[model samples]
Structure formats: structure tokens, C-alpha cells
Target: MLAKRALSIAGGLAVLGWPFAVWLALTYPELHILLPILALCFVLRLCALRGKTGALSRAFKGLALAGAVLCIASIWMREAQLLLWYPVVVNAVMLTLFGSSLFSRMTIVERLARWREGELPPEGVRYTRKVTQIWCFFFLFNGSVSLFTCLAGNIHWWTLWNGMVSYLLMGLLFACEWLVRQRVRRRYE
Candidate 1:
């Protein structure tokens, strides 16, 4: 159990630190050295998901597989440029996960809210759906920008946008959503 938890934490950290990892791999031009480590991280993450069951779990597993594949491809092709696409792929996977949930009985945000609040009133349900839509929009926009960074062929620019700016934007969005959610909750109360 402890080993499983450690693998999960390592995998999560790998995913979160991907941008910096890519930046290091690219700046040093030693992709062969780093790609295998990344692939291993993804594999560890995949292994950690072994007993989980759910669409979300499957989606995350798929993401880990994709990341591993990309790393392997970068290594095979001896191309550091391929590593830049990892962020774009991350955004695309996120968009798919969040966007697909919109058509389900409950949006992803709604499920998370329900989990926390025990059950949502009608107004809360509506708010959660809207929040989910906002997240879909964010993923789409962020993915596009990530793709642009890959195409721009500027390592510093890519690192700046994917590594730093995108995170800041995500945090800002989360902060704004929390503030709005508090107001909505008060209004409904």
C-alpha cells in the first residue's frame, strides 16, 4: 500500500512537472537520456492506476499511455522538438475529458461539487454545469496556445508559456471560480 501510494505521488509529480522536464530535456539536447526517465514515470503512473475503475480513471490511464508513447517517439526519432508537443497533448486530453463530461448526466464539476456538498440544489447544479463549460473553454484555449508554443520554435517562449503562464492562468481561473461559487452559494442561501 505504501509503495502504491509512492508510485501515485511520483506519477502525479511527473505529470505536474512535465513542462520543466521538457524544458530541461530541450535546453540540454539530451532527449535520449531524459525520455526514458519520462517514459518510466508514465509507466509508473499507469501501474499506480491498476485497480482504479471509472471513466476518469481510464482517461488518466490513457493520458499516461499517450505521454509514454510521446517520450518513446522522441527518443526513437532523436528529435527534441517532439517533446514540445507534450503540453499540447496534455491540453487536448484535458479538453476531451472535461468536454465529454458535459454531455453526461452530470458534468465533471457537478460531480466534484456533489462529492463535497453531499447534494446540490437546482441552482448549484446549474452553477456547476456553467463552471464545467468554463473549464472546457479554458482547456480549448489553453490547448491552442500550447500548440502555438510548439509551432513557434522558440524554446524560451515555449517554456515561458507552457511552464509558467499557463499555470498562472489556471490558478487565476480557479480563484475567480471560487469567488463566484461563494457568491452563488450565498445567493442561493
Candidate 2:
């Protein structure tokens, strides 16, 4: 489980650093040649998942397989615009996950908070629900901007927003939420 989590963290960082990877690939032809190796890594990770049963798990495995295929295909084709599409797709997937959870028994944020706090008070539960809603909106807006930048065909602008600006905004949101949660817990708990 630790190895799986580490791999997940590395994969997320790779996605976040994709623009830099592209720069390196362009600067050194040998780096571009590593695409197949990356694809193999994806395939290996997928194979390691053998027998996971949840819908979310299956969906993620499918996405990983598709990513592997895309990596291999991109090597033979000239679909450079995919670099722009990646962030948009990733944000959309995340948005779907968060948005769908809002209609379930508990929002994703609530579920996470409960994992830490065990049973939350009614107020805490309500607050987590609101936070999850805010996250859904954030993902929607972020994905929209990513799609707009992709269509605009400016790699620099896409990289600027997706790589740096989007992450900063997310970090700001996370920090603000943490601060607010602390204050709320002190007052009501």
C-alpha cells in the first residue's frame, strides 16, 4: 500500500511537471525516446492492480491503460496538442469524481474528514459538505480555463496557468480551508 501511494504521488507530480518534461523532450531527442519506457511503466502499474473491484478502481485502471496507449501512439503520431489536452482531461476527471460524490451519502471532503475525526458533529458535517461544493466549482472553473487555453493554442499560456497558477490557487484554497476549519472547530466543538 505504501508503494502504491508512492507511485500515485510520483504519477501526480509527473502530470503536474508535464510542461517541463515536454521542454526536456524537445531539447534532447533521447528524452523523447523514453516515451515507450514511460508507457511500459504505465502498463506495469496497471497489471499490478490485478483484481481490484470498485467502480472507481476499475475506472482509474482503465484511464491508466488509455494513458499508456496514448503515450505509445503519441510517439508515432504528431499529436503535440495532447500536451494541452492532458490538464483539461485530468481536471475534468477529478471534477467528475468530486461532483458525483456530492450526490452520495457523504461528500468526498466529509468522507476524508471523518476518516481523521471519526464522527464529526452536525456542524462539521455541514461545513465539509459546503467545502466539497466549493471544490466542485473550483474544478469546473479550472477545467474550463484549461480547455480554453488548449483551444487558444498557446503552450506558454497553458503551461503558465495549468502548471503554476492552477496549483497556487488550489494551495491557497487548501490553506484557507484549513484555517477556517480550525477557527470553526474552536468556536463550536
Candidate 3:
């Protein structure tokens, strides 16, 4: 449990680091390298996998790696425009997904879903439902916003790709959450 908790924190940091690193690497150019980041990610994933179920930690680790690559790419390509505001996106994800963990009880679905392993249980059905809905809105907004930024031609490749991935992943999770809720409600009623 402690291990998983730490993994979540580290994962959280990495998530926050995404845009900052992307901007720094892009703007600072000659200073960044891909190998160390990849290696660190691999190590974190390995550590995270130990204390938690295979499914949960692995997904985050994957997200970290994918995110790191996108960041590195953005840096290589010199796209650092959104480095400052990227934390808003990170905060949104953290609050919606992780913040829910702090208040919620062990959600039956989350327990089964494997995404909530190291995190606290959801508070209740209402909390879970609301969080899911909020995430849906986030995805829809970010997905569209990132693409628009991409078109404006100032955004880094990293930001665009990361935004797309975030949007897609959140939308998928939201749909899955909605379906589970529907099934549960139908079954119970």
C-alpha cells in the first residue's frame, strides 16, 4: 500500500512535470537527452508495479512514458509556447482523478477497474459520477483546444499529441464509467 501510494505521488509529479519539461527541453535545446528520461520512467514503472495490481500501475507508467516521449519530441522540435499554462491541465487531471480519491470510499467499480489501486476509494456514487462527468467535459474541451493550438502553429508537437492522448483517454474512461453506471443502476433497480 505504501509503495503504491508513493508511486501515485511520483506519478503525480511526472504528470505535473510534463509541460514544464517539454518547454524547458525545447527552449534549452542542447541540454536534454531522451535516454535518462526513458530509463527513469522504466524504473518508476517497475517500482510502481511491485506493490499494486498489474493493471493499474502499468497504465500510469505507460502514460508517463508516452508523456515523456511527447515532451521530448516537443523539445526537439522547439515548441515551448504552452509551458506556462500546462499545469492547468495537470491540475485538472490530478483533481478530477486523484482528488476524488481523497474523498471517496472504495468505489466498487474503481476497485474492479484497476485504476484506483494505490489511491483512496471514492467517497460515494455521487462523487464518482460527478468526477466522471467533469472529466468528460475536460476531455472534450482539451481535445478541441489542443487541436486549435496545433493549427495556430505555435504549439509544440508534444503539447498537441499529449492533449490528444489525454482527451482520448479521458473520453474512453468517461464512456466506460457511464456504461458501468447504467448497468449497475439497471441491475439494482
- Name the candidate, 1 or 2, with the larger TM-score value: 1
Instruction: Give the TM-score (vs. native) of candidate 2.
Output: 0.81
Clashes of 1: 0
What TM-score fits each model?
0.94, 0.81, 0.45
User: Rank by TM-score, descending?
Assistant: 1, 2, 3
> Cα lDDT of model 2 overall?
0.74
Candidate 2 local lDDT, 62-94, one digit each (tens): 656765776767787855445456667667777
Best by lDDT: 1
Residue 73, candidate 1: C-alpha displacement in angstroms: 1.1
Q: Candidate 2 at 19: error in angstroms?
A: 2.6
RMSD of 1: 1.4
Clashes of each: 0, 0, 6
Colliding residue pairs in candidate 2: none
